[model samples]
Target: MAQTTAKYHCLVTGFGPFYRYTEEENPAWLAVKPLTNSIIEDEQNNVRPIHVSTLQLPVSYQAVMDVVPLLHSHPPVFHPSIAEQAARNGVARPQKGYDFILHVGVAGRGALRVERVAHKFGYNMKDIYGRQAPVVETAPLPVEPEEPGDVPEEVLHISAPQIEQNQLELAEGPEPTPEPIRPKRGFGPGYENFQEEVYSDVNVVSLIRNMKQQNFEDVYLSMDAGHYLPDFIYYCSLAEVIRSVKPYERRRGTQVLVVHVPPVGQPLTSEQVTTALKLIITWVCSELQSIDDTLAKERFQ
Candidate 1:
């Protein structure tokens, strides 16, 4: 029997200490630290082909905007422009590009929340520096031409599927030799007439059900991701996934998820939070593997 290669790549991020929370450690980063470069094993004792890269993001609105574009272009690895800074800090880049993005933050509440939806707009909140965020801000999404004539000639020459293919290729970068025909998940930019909200395109309901089956206590789904950075990051990350990958490939491309954990010494212990993080990561990898296997089977058929 031959050893199998890793099949999936994931990026996990936690916020650095900020504001009033500065006195205590951020539970999100602490929980995620042990998972970096760790391989999860399924029940059969076979290693799940998943590689995780972790990053600690600054607690600033500007930081979110600056980092997201870099993530979109070359995830797990900083863009060339920031390579020096990333290296100086000993940041680890993924062996390859990432297939999933998970943002973890402390909710200061007791339960572990697997967020169901991320609102498109954010409330007026102040960052660490006392800088104020706009009353409402929309994450950038792909825009279609209003008129047929407005379409770019380069884009017009390609068929609908081909256009999607091209977008997928550009998003994944030149290296790693892109996987052919993965299922992409699309997140609609919510309602135009009403307040916009982007739901988690990943199968959260199934994930929650699976968690319950595992007998993990206090794990529940919540519609609100939060009004602050967790919500902002989720919205931006999802928007980037939409802008970067095609609709068909987005489902299989990169799954964006945000997990809100209670602060330490509240109702949950640090160990419990770590357990929840591991559970979420493992489930994500399993789902991606299923998707990959399905696509591979379809190709042969």
Candidate 2:
């Protein structure tokens, strides 16, 4: 029988405008924003319900550094209605930390990519602010501030660039202005104790296969998440998960998966991307629920 009463929660984040995406809302946010505060259920597959919450993040290293830790250590509260629904279903309120965190970013045209790895060292590309992550001897897992006063404002909220609401077009903005030069930071020559690369816990190969079976033609598994904002955020999220899991665990890596979607109307509309997200989320949730069921059964036997 399906665990119809079980509910899974996920935190989905999308990047704000940057590069050619500055004029309009980012395609990532356009697709992710609609799914915010929504619940997904697959009755046919008997998949548990999934509650999703979303927040828009700026394309800056500082912003990501400030935010990812809070997400892992102290997740934001979901809608009251979601809680009421869970209560009505007779499921416990979700505990600390989300079941998964899906970070979506804009990438090449016409293809949807499920990124498998995040690198600790190659963050060479500057953010929209013309600044890059500083070089470090080792990759440090972000720690939530022990004192509330120590938390930075950026950690609490990031304001997106002002633009007309719901506007998603390729229209050119005012003449391009040269970005001011900012000091560059490095991530050291080599990754030492903090392993050079971290992979996602999710079976991305299986994910792509399932999506293809469902007619999501353009989805592919990607090894390279690039050396940009997407990569930066992915590393932070993966690292956070690494820090939480015990060393003895048979399965490691992270529940964090980064998906790269093409710009709006580049052979795929935001609506299309949104549908893909629902399918992907459903598959991921079902896999996780199965794992939980196995663990629960083994505990009693």
Top TM-score prediction, candidate number: 2
Off by over 4 Å in 2: 1-4, 74-93, 138-192, 248-254
Candidate 1 lDDT over 1-301, as tens digits, reads 3435765666788888876576238888777777766666665535456666677787766677668657766535475544664565445555435777889988867788889888765445677767654433245688865898877898678788998998898888866665684222212233243336767778888888888888887788889876788888887787766666665652455788999888887788888888877778888777777777678778879
Over 59-175, each residue of candidate 2 has an lDDT whose tens digit, in order, gives 888777766755676444334433453334332224556787899999978789899998776677888899778756544579865786777877556444424331333254455
Candidate 1 regions with alpha-carbon error over 4 angstroms: 1-3, 43-47, 74-96, 134-195, 247-251
User: What is each predicted model's overall lDDT from 0 to 1?
Assistant: 0.71, 0.76
Ten-residue stretch with the least lDDT total in model 2: 161-170
- In model 2, the Cα lDDT at residue 162 comes to 29
- Pick the lDDT winner: 2
lDDT of 1 at 228: 83
Instruction: Supply candidate 1's per-residue lDDT for 125.
Output: 68
**TM-score attained by model 2:** 0.74
